[model samples]
Target: MSRLTDLIARTKGNDPQLGADLEREFKALSSRLPYGLNFERHSPEAVELPLRPVRKGDKVRVLPERGSTKKGDQRLWQVKAIQKAKKLADLELLGPAKTETQSVALDDLVVVAEFRDTIYPGLVSTGKVERGGDKPFHTVINGENYHALKALTYAYRGKVDAIYIDPPYNSGAKDWKYNNDYVESDDLYRHSKWLAMMERRLLLAKDLLNPAESVLIVTIDEKEYLRLGLLLEQLFSYATIQMVSSQINPKGVSRGGSFRRSDEYLYFVMFGTARPCRMPLSSEWSTSTQSDLENSSEDGSPVTPDWTSMMRRGSEAYRNDRPSMFYPIYADPITRKISAVGAALPNGEHAAPPKKGLVAILPIRKDGSEGRWQIGASELESRIKQGRVRLGRSTSYGFVVNYLPDGAYADVISEKFLIQGYADDGSVIAFSEAGDLSRVASTQWKIASHNASENGSSLLATLLPKRKFPFPKSLYAVEDALRFFVLEKKDAVVLDFFSGSGTTAHAVMRLNRQDQGKRRCISITNNEVAADEQKALREQFLRPGDADWEKYGICDFITKPRVKAAITGKTPEGGSIKGDYKFTDEFPIADGFEENAEFFTLTYEAKSAVNHNLAYARIAPLLWLRAGAQGLRIDKLPPEGWALVNTYGLLTEVDAAAPFINAVRQAKALRVAYIVTDDDRRFQAIAQQLPRAVEPVRLYESYLTNFSFSNGE
Candidate 1:
């Protein structure tokens, strides 16, 4: 045997417990299967490609090599076969020369797929709501969330305080799509494809979260919760993970035989010391408290008294079930004060009898049935020592046991004490000496206000009379979930990549309006039409490439309109639907959320040889958006293509470097300057002239490189 193995064997002989553990571990390792999570008939070599090479029947173009072809020599070719052994691909030439076949090196070809706005990763402002002041403006991006997330990494990487996403739950009702097709329930690899999509986006999202002070909240249903939990655990191993069951649908959806589904879950993966804020309990809970506890003391201090029934009422209340909890409590009969707690013996006998004039308090129900105490003998003794346990008059029956409210003397209650059956209203319940009841929010969130789907649809229907979107989350739910984390962080930046129906942005606006705080939201979603809608559009001779087709998709039709109506209190046709608030009694609906939001669509620059050859027109708007869209004027271009926006000077050409620096010197308070140039020497020379407060950033070299992707022509 090897030395290490021999030593372990010897150690096992000497220490059997440790040895057994090692033996079991070794057996577990030996018994493990070679592969895990096998998908039937799926082969990595046959199906999966990391870089996604052009396959048979794919349209492609020959990329011109240096000094090899004329400027317009490239032509579209249809791929026939990729011969891996020979590193060559068979291609058939298109357009008039239909029968021409040729073999070319793999490196000489590029896929000819149309470029998605997200794939290009540049922002083009479509419209804006001018607040006409220094108010924070929210952003809504109309593009694929994946590309939008990638673009955001350039500007908001490690800067966002929180990310809340309600991704498609992959329920089999054509709720979501993959590769432009709805993944049905029968699709064997549906789970795998969902995981693959989520993994890519989540990795990018992890970079955007501030590791020291952020939390990532993802909502999911029963279909993929187990797989998603494992994925979250794998990716965020360092975070403090918690899974909360949120009641979004009180009226359960019936599925015969199986349990009716009523609740979805929120996976809160918190990094560092991030925690939820405390919230006040509903007035119903406060009114239910005993009236005597609300009375003041002789010195005018609020008199706080804790109370609990002497008898245990649940399944484990029998003396035989928990003999340790069937202990005796000795109290002075006249004073009605607990003097000592007596332990129960192994034979279910009392350790000692009560002294003269002292009566033993046995746990007895109203029907005189034998029962056990709420706490064990050790805990009873601890409470007695702290002068918390007392014999008091019962409102329902005879003399009963009472105790001080846990943490009654402290200014605020700890979360641990609240978890011990303190209140039935919610997870974390707290009671103050002034008879005030508050809820200390924790991982276990079971609030009735966070109903899953109906409220969301109702709110949307109120905003846009006849329009409908499937399975939207309640706005109050999102607002409450964020209120737990960002209540104190008024200026925090919140991002939601899967921004369906724009609920997260609406929640943020509501929060800001309620608290008069400035919190900005960035929402990104795709403009893809539903499967049935796409079919209908195609039947009407409308194609995906047509602008009219896109107007009917989720981003343009649902997300944008919902956000606009929410902020403006007017429908898409400019009709006011403002009246009483349907969900809450606190505010009128017509008060209208006073906020500003800018809408932008993702666009791409023309394909170029050098990575940094992107034009100034494309890079300028992105800079404006990243700087919070302050004073953005896309209609007018400055003389030298250099403009001062907010606190930054954006120079598109190095030739305008002298004028840009002169302008920066003129405005001595410039915080930073972004210079777009391909030449390194020019960037350095211009950067040297800027003041110390003005940090210089090379647009193409530094900023743009972060978002550069391999677009196959």
Candidate 2:
């Protein structure tokens, strides 16, 4: 037992909750080692939330009721006294004139919190930027993500479609509080803190995800990939786990005598019904003429232009096999032009003969048994309009019809084809232009084998030319990872707690632009400066919360601005960025996304006030996220005691239930409604009257219910 540990240990015994990693650090730091400038955030700058109640001498800052403050209420003040009855606190200025005092609502004040303290989280809108249109607002929250995740559980529990996190690799690099060089060992002392941190956040993250169908993507380097896998297994025991070794760092880092570390691990914890979607690979041999997979006829005959028999060949060719597909194709024998198609008959029933003037073409086999067409009646009609289905040759009854097999028939049924336009016959001319359908993503993703070896630094420089990070993920790499999951989920709710530099958000925007999807990304990061920078700031007598100090924090300095530049298509100086995105989809950088975004700072609120509806303003954004981050939000209490929007509604007063119910009936696309009341009977009565589609959530009770649970995290 080191003397340093003994000194910090509780009077009777050591604090059981205190991490053993901290104990090791206490010993080493006290052993007198030389400190380095390689540092990280000034934690105090992001938050000075000492987990204690406000007292007469505690220095604090006042808060704005609406929107985020630019310079924040930086003037220092002391908690003069508490008026419990009025629910107000008096704050005295901490300057030379100590007598000046003012009273403010206790709810507006944030006193910070500890584990024991139940925090009612609040959102302060910093600002917003829009590229236009009615896109759901992608959010970037600047706060300690641990508390922020807890807050999100109330809004997004059981609703998130995917969560992709690039957590700290826990390489034990020298930082603000460090006194040594980067340590590569994965010993208990180094790994314990990171594992514990991830365990806590992942557990909370579980509540946010849709257990029925969601994916948890975590990227880690060799430093903690093994530990992360074990921890993920421990936490998500029921999930289908798989690790993808992506060669993100193709040019491996030569760390002393060991092999150069290049590849990193991506662990995908897939929940129920969640699976990787197959992607298309542009065929090397495929030309515009060979877009169709086949070239010759089954009878060893030469090709006839771009047409193939409508009769399904090979296996499953019998009418009984696909009874509904054995329908008739109506064609004009004289003109050899298809007029219309007949409907599919029930099993054991025959298709009704075509009208008198039209000749019916049946899938009759040479062996004299009935066969089925390649597609159904409706599919044939659609293909006929595309000019894909046309007359092939004269048959006994009419001109035998054929359809253009431009691509794999199976792919046409299961994949999203890129439609070029309609042909003269109203046919949907399309192409399968990307990944090869038959190619599967291999477990060992070597850099030499894949095109995803994008330099993280070089890629970030394209979006943010002036800023940099210790490890910024390649934008294209994130976009590729997201495409596998969100490609099919147009409205997926993707979350990234460790959203350093807001790379995930930028990636989502690019994904949405490619497919025109509604996937909303929620990014959370702290506004903390680098350790060496913090040291420099302190030397100038600048402290946390100071404008200059806060400016360099990650959220203010990088994440928010990066996302803004992506959305507005301009640099901080309001000039077009000098480049185009050619990595995946080639587009000019100045051509910003047609998306909307809002910035927020997750702040502490009084739990009591939340239960009594006194903190509704602060909690509105949380509810908006829960209802799906689309359309307008219920950011303020409605004057009519209730509010209705495209996605959600709120009923503040049950007396106004009639109006609220009428509004609910009128809303064409309301998914969730919140009732602000204390009485369980009142809540149920109101809930029963609401439409079946509207999920009636008890606003105040919902807040407390989310807080009611506890776990070791």
Candidate 3:
């Protein structure tokens, strides 16, 4: 053995695993050798020629050796005609090289084939699950970009149920990489890539949705909202579109020019739902609490407690178009009950008592106070019981109290009472206004009078932290959009390719926590700006200077920051963050290959020998299975009415009259043996003479390459 082989063998003898890897590399090198031309073997004495495969139709790239300076130059050849060796002189390109060339073997020429292109971007291949320590829940491959997204199209090919995309808006700040290129503001294809990228993802996304369930909602902004809409129309046959203006926050963007645009609009488009054009009631629901009301305490009133301001605001809102249910609320102090609840009538009209039982509160004494005011629940119950309440005469339900007012009137009067100033000690603020207490009536709230004190920011604050993550969407916003479709015990899969700071993930987490629903979110992000890296850096600051990064979040950082906040109750929105989150970083398998299976050796046998026959059985017939082919037809059968079969053809039977049949029928004589004959009746008749004899017959021809039967007679 060579010194190198000896050293490798010695090293492998010590480290078996490394030795196996080295051996694999060595074997791979042999299989990757360059292929070559074909040659005809007319005679063993004749020399071979270097020639290509003369197929009926073959298109190949040609490389010409034009530069003469090179000593060992090989000319580049392109596609030539399909001709025999004798007709080579007819081809123009073959004329120059024929004089100096000799016949060559067929294996000496490289063969080429036509190129095939695909729309898929990444490599998608099935692989076995590897179980060990520090592994993810499961390994899914070829999920990168177009490849991953397109793979989903196969299962949902040609149709889909719904398409929801939260792609990066290309704000010029966040990292949104497209095709190995960062989408910076300077690049012209920034919008094109964004569109194209979205276009491809959307095509696949669109196919996944069912025709009946074909509804797509894109949460995008001024950047590419119109473009996205156009793309949608082009991709989908039926497109009914609408844009909903959602007041996400009362605050506006400060451009230092004119005004800030605080609120954003969501483009809602539907293709095949029962209701299109009109915004359908979302399966998603929003949760409202005292936290949602601005400037008001948990008691639900304006901070300042100005009765006049409340009255003015109430009167204004009363005149404007508002939900009939939100009309004015008037109460009498005496019974401490609501007298009338509705919008004010026009032309200074006094609303008639629609119900006889309906009664407003009357001050017991001269002034309404803590002791003198109270409403009777039974009185209101009596009104309903007595049929005092009147239904609306027309479609518009005017102010009509069904029963006597039941609840106590709020302390502060007037709409302005919503505003409150700081006290000297900042302990208790005064409710300065007590405008009027004549009649409690239904009223509409005016848009202009809508103040901050009437708004709630708690729920909104939770999803959108204070600079925690920029442009973080409000959890309540997501809830409002998703609540309808969500249900208990239902497992839903939510995917967002444009996952930023994982708002969608957070929203899903919050939803699951509240409803105990089984919803999993598959968020895809390119980490363009290195969001994960930035998070790591921030985490480093939070840790001790000397803490090892690999081990830092191992236990402490087991959860993502968002997940940590979710579980630890450290959310921006006050309230408990719910449920435990398991974080797993998915990684691709290292680039290489591994052995799929191992083969074992077997001993030689008579049956093995028979299988190796060309006229009978082919040698190494077992190789046919490895060659990915199956089944064989045998034309002949064994003749043994009473015969002795050895191990090769075991003959273990004994019979006085029919020995061959007895031997053939012996169980000990045939482990890997069977029989056949051209004449069944003759074989059977002879077999009857033997105690335990059998017969064999022919089937078809052999297909095995190595099959042959050679015996010295």
Ranking by TM-score: 1, 2, 3
Can you give the lDDT of residue 102 in candidate 1? 89
Q: Which stretches of candidate 2 lie over 4 Å from their true place?
A: 1-112, 175-188, 282-438, 447-455, 710-713
Q: What is the C-alpha lDDT of each candidate?
A: 0.68, 0.72, 0.35
Clashes of each: 2, 18, 124
- Scored by lDDT, model 2 comes in at 0.72
Cα lDDT tens digits, model 2, 227-334, are 777778767889999999777666788878899987788999999998877554333213323213443335322222335677788999998898888887776677
Which RMSD values do the candidates have, in order? Answer: 11.5, 15.2, 25.7
Candidate 3 TM-score to native = 0.35
Residues 1-713, candidate 3: write the lDDT tens digits. 36656766887998765675565455545444253311121111110111223332222223112222221213323323433554331112222435433322222232332111122111212222121121111111212334344434432343433334566777664456553335687875567667656665676566555556445667776667777666666666476676655555456666558667555556655656422211112111112222223223455433332111111122323323322222233443334344554442333333423445543321112132111112233433344343222221111222222211222123322342332543331212334244211221111111211121222233223422442334555544554344333432234444555544444544555555455554444444322224344345444442112234322321122113343343334543444543222212111111111111111111122333333332232222222211111122122233332233232121222223344443444545332222233344544454454333222322111211112211101
Give candidate 1 regions above 4 Å deviation: 1-120, 283-437, 441-454, 582-585, 606-613, 631-642, 652-672, 677-696, 708-713
**Top of the candidates by lDDT:** 2
In order of lDDT, best first, we have 2, 1, 3
Q: How many residue pairs of model 3 clash at the backbone?
A: 124
- Across residues 1-713, which tens digit of lDDT does each residue of candidate 1 receive? 26656766887998765675566455545644464432221111111111235666666666544333232234567788989898888998875424888898776665553222223456777777654256667889977677677778767878788899999898877877665456798988888878867876898899889988898999998998998898888778899888988777777888667999888899988888787654444432233333334322344333333345546877888878777777677766666566677767455464346577767767666675667777788886776665455565633433577655564424234431322333321122334533433344444555666765656887788887788788788888898788888988998899999998999998998888777878899999877777667656665655443577778778888988888888777888888865555443356555568788888876544434125444556555666655555554443346667888566787876787788888898884456687767788888999999888777888666654664542111
